[model samples]
Each structure stands twice: as C-alpha cells, then as structure tokens.
Target: MAEVHSRSSHRELRVQAGASDNVTANELFDIEEQRNRLSRMFCFDGMGGALLIEPSFPGCGMIDAGKGDLIYSNALYEIKAGDRLFRSVDVRQLITYSALNYVSKRFQIDSLGLFNPRVGVSATIPVDDLCAEISGKQSSDLFFDIVAAISSGDISR
Candidate 1:
C-alpha cells in the first residue's frame, strides 16, 4: 500500500499492491513522494509560466505520444519515480518527446532530461545530441519506415 499526497489538490491517494510484491508499500509511498517533490520543485507559479507538467502531445499521422512530466523553458524533463538511475528506455522516451516536440514546432524543445529524485540523479542532453543518438540506432530506420508505411496506408509488405 502506498499513500500519495498531492500538493496541488491537497489530497491523499492511497495505492495498494499484493503482499507478494517485491517492493514494499513504504517504498512505493517514498517513490510517489519524490515524484511530487520534484514536480513542485520545477513548477513556477500556480498556473502557467515556463514550466508545464504532464503536457500531452497529440499524435500526428504516425504517432501520438505525450504526457511529459515537465517542460521548463526550452527543456523537456521526464521524471522517473525510482531510486535507480535513468535507464535506456527513459532516455529513449525523452528523446522521442524532444524530437516530436521539435518537429511539431509548437514547443521547440531545446534539450531533454531524465530526473530521478530518489537518488537525486539527473542527466540533461541537448536536443541535437539526442537526435543524433536516436538516428544512430539501427531500429530508427525501421521506425521511420513504419511511419512512412502508415502515412502511405501501405502496411502490407
């Protein structure tokens, strides 16, 4: 079981897991606490400012992805609610968000970041580097191919 406290709503959310779970309820609660703390740390003003939390990006023709944890100025942040460092999947997701946000030209993200509040670890990379890394991946070509196929309405190869 985990009790999460929301600062914005001033309410508590309780979450419970099976007793056979590997993670304890206290750990879950701690993770949620860290997430809330991180959100508050970056948010400016009560409404809108430079920081936007959990902003969703509607899918274009190929992909629809969003709900980014935070966006400060030109930087987009993805929060990981765990004590461990950022994993490859976390980086990939942030990079994707950055790339999509940039392509959309609506947000123009300049950088991407992964933050883990539990261990106080954070990695920030420029959008260009992220794009390069993503491009270098072998799967990138396949991903683009899929997008192209979807756009052309020709999935059958």
Candidate 2:
C-alpha cells in the first residue's frame, strides 16, 4: 500500500503495514495514545489536503475494534474508499475503509468486524441519510460509497 499524504498541514500521520508499529487495542486504551497515533496518521494523510481525524469519544462507542475500552477515530479523506482499500469494486465500502485505514469501519448496532469477520454479511445502504444522521457531520461520503460497494463485493481500488 502507498503511504498516506497530507500537504496543507504540519501534522501528518501515515502508518504503513510495516513502516511503523501498529497500535493494538490493549495499547491504545488511553485517550492520549489514541490521539497520538491518530494525529500521526491524520497529518500523514492530509499533508497537502485539509482533513482531520476526530475520535468519537465519551458516547460514540459503537464501533468496537477491541474492547469498548479502545477508541475509534472517524477520518475525513479526499480519496475514495476503493482507492484506500486497494480492492476492486467487488469489495464493500466498510471493508474498503477497514483495509485502507487499518481501522474498523462499523455498521449497524452490532460490532461487525470489518478487517476479518468470522461470519461475513453485507453492510451497504444509502449514505445520504446516514451522513445526515450524525452530529458534527463532515462531507466525506467516499467512505460510505465504498461501504455500499464492499457490502455487495463491488469495490475497485
């Protein structure tokens, strides 16, 4: 996978599969650690572009990558989810997000594993309504499009 880039900002964060150590749920239980890691990737991804990785904390504990104790950050990227995932249109949006960011892209009330699930299920739906459903909403629907695709196995990296 290519390294994430961000040019408009000074804080760049790019966590390649082997470039740097991956932060496990056990290691990122604390807010500071999660912030630091996310900040790094944020700066890296949004180097020239303007974007932010806001961690859904306090009450946004629905996407469980590890224990609900661990945190998840919602990323705003300029690229499409398929581009990020490095997959064809056969992949789903949430799955693409998971593959690209190395973070779980959640769906529904259940914590379905995005990276690799024991039982796979389609998780695609209209993003317009979902984007409207969230507070502090940002215009980053590419991820949603990818989710819509991946849920149906139609992703193109």
Best by lDDT: 1
How do the residues 1-157 of candidate 1 rate in per-residue lDDT, one tens digit apiece?
Answer: 2222233443334545673488888878775777566655554335433655576665545556656776766677887866577788987677565445544555657777887777766778876666567675433453454355545655543
TM-score of each: 0.59, 0.21
Residue 20, candidate 1: alpha-carbon lDDT: 47
Candidate 1 regions exceeding 4 Å error are 1-49, 134-157
Name the 10 consecutive residues with the lowest summed lDDT in model 2. Answer: 110-119
Model 2 TM-score (2 dp):
0.21
- TM-score: model 1 vs. ground truth: 0.59
**In candidate 2, which residue ranges exceed 4 Å CA deviation?**
1-29, 44-46, 52-91, 95-157
Residue 7 lDDT in candidate 2: 42
Which one wins on TM-score?
A: 1
lDDT per residue for candidate 2 within 1-157, as digits (tens), equals 1222344434433333433367654433433444454444434433334332322212112332322211112322222222123233333333333333332443222121122111112233233333444323432454444334445544433
By summed lDDT, the worst window of 10 consecutive residues in model 1 runs over 1-10
